[model samples]
Target: MPTERRIGPARERDRLADAREDERAHAVIRNVRAARMVAGRADSAEECSLLLEMLGLEPAAERR
Candidate 1:
């Protein structure tokens, strides 16, 4: 005979929390990429600066 393992409510809740965090991280990445694309196509430095500021991201020069 063999015993089976089961997930408790606590473990389930932890798993859900981890999944939500992963989703939030992925959303942040997507938003950053989208902002980069828009910034790349911006007509002027001022526009790019404003877009980066609104997205709460640093400029490319400062990232390195």
Candidate 2:
């Protein structure tokens, strides 16, 4: 039977780093939205907070 090689520790770490970067990108968007609210240009801080929550993230919590 043909088998595939499993990822080693380094590759696993790289994958995790990539996932973290993706999450940070999302956080940046939320941060921008929250900033807009602070700047008096938007009225959807609640909506932005909800988006973050739906992404398995919570505003004001440390990123995992």
Candidate 3:
């Protein structure tokens, strides 16, 4: 039981680290780091669009 409890927090910490790294990667590409943060949450292109619309923000300007 003790071992099981340790594993849960370890896994959660790892997941949070991965999420932070993902946003850091995005920060390098876009002005608003938050964009990368939100993009990480979206499961699909459609979902991303919906999120953007709701936030009243435009899609990333046509990637070169």
The candidate that wins on TM-score is: 1
Q: Give me the candidate number with maximum lDDT.
A: 1
Model 2 compared with the native: what TM-score? 0.52
**Sliding window of 10 residues with minimal summed lDDT for model 1:** 55-64
- Across 16-44, the per-residue lDDT of candidate 2 in tens digits comes to 99999999999889876764454354257
Q: Give stretches of model 3 more than 4 Å off.
A: 1-31
Q: Which should have the higher lDDT, number 2 or number 3?
A: 3
Clashing pairs for predicted structure model 3, backbone only: none
1-64 in candidate 1: lDDT tens per residue? 6588889999999999999999999988887797789787999989988888887776765565
Off by over 4 Å in 2: 41-64
Between candidates 1 and 2, the TM-score winner: 1
Ranking by lDDT: 1, 3, 2
- Please give the ranking of all candidate structures by TM-score, highest first, separated by commas: 1, 2, 3
